[model samples]
Target: MDPRSPPPGDGRLTPADLRLWAVLGLALVFLALAALFLAAPALGALIYGVPAPEGIGRTALRAIGARDAALALYLAGLALFSTRRAVAIVLAASLVIPACDLVLILSAGTAAWWQVALHGVSAGVLALTALWLARRNHSA
Candidate 1:
């Protein structure tokens, strides 16, 4: 069997497969970031003395983590099937979620500068990674 050929049976991943994996990996990271943002209050309450908003924070956290988990599962699917387009679409959606979170956090005006910076950096890293993966998709 040629190593260059797709995996035997149904589970085979090639260079292109890896590229898709990279995309999905980046998405997972971003989804994690978004989850962190949404879970900020719960996190803070768990850690610091800062008071969280009412039901809003809880709802947001649930949504964020739920989506993040879903994205992670999709990423796992990419790994299993070795398909690029499907993973790319999921990753692209992952990117948008964090960008929206960044905008919301900035507009909310309650968060500290450092928190904004951290989230911004995380979002940038995720986007950059996905872009690189897309560019190197064929080589993966």
Candidate 2:
């Protein structure tokens, strides 16, 4: 094989490939934040009363802020060569937190339909982005 050609299964991603992944990840983070902002208060109203469910509301707010912060960090990482894998790892980690939250909400028997919908949509987007990134990395 030519030395210039990447070997099969080398697990390396080109800069362009990495950029695509980063963009998709950043989009997911923003989408999640937006959805949380719109949905969380409504969800709180449905589950609790006019006041709001303090515990769940607080958690949702935190998730929104965390997602935004994660996106900022992800973009910064994307620009730094040493942080490429770190960005991917952080994006990957973001997926798990929401999933666990979904499970917890479901177990509470609180009829968290909006949360499920938002989480499903966000997860689908993130998963697709991650898959594209992985495939591009593999091909590189």
List candidate 2 segments past 4 Å from native: 1-51, 54-60, 79-86, 137-140
> 27-85 in candidate 1: lDDT tens per residue?
57646655674556477333212235567656755565666667667676775576444
Return the TM-score for candidate 2, rounded to 2 decimals. Answer: 0.53
After superposition, which runs of candidate 1 have C-alpha atoms over 4 Å from their true positions?
Answer: 1-41, 44-51, 55-57, 136-140
Clash count per candidate:
1, 0
Tens-digit lDDT track of model 2 for 1-140 = 88765445533444565555665556565656556545675543343212344766666655555556566566455535433344456556667855865676577666456656766766676565555554534343
Give residue 104's lDDT in candidate 1 (0 to 100).
71
Q: For this target, which candidate reaches the highest lDDT against the unseen true structure?
A: 1
- Which pairs of residues collide in model 2? none
Best by TM-score: 1
Q: Can you give the lDDT of residue 1 in candidate 2? A: 80
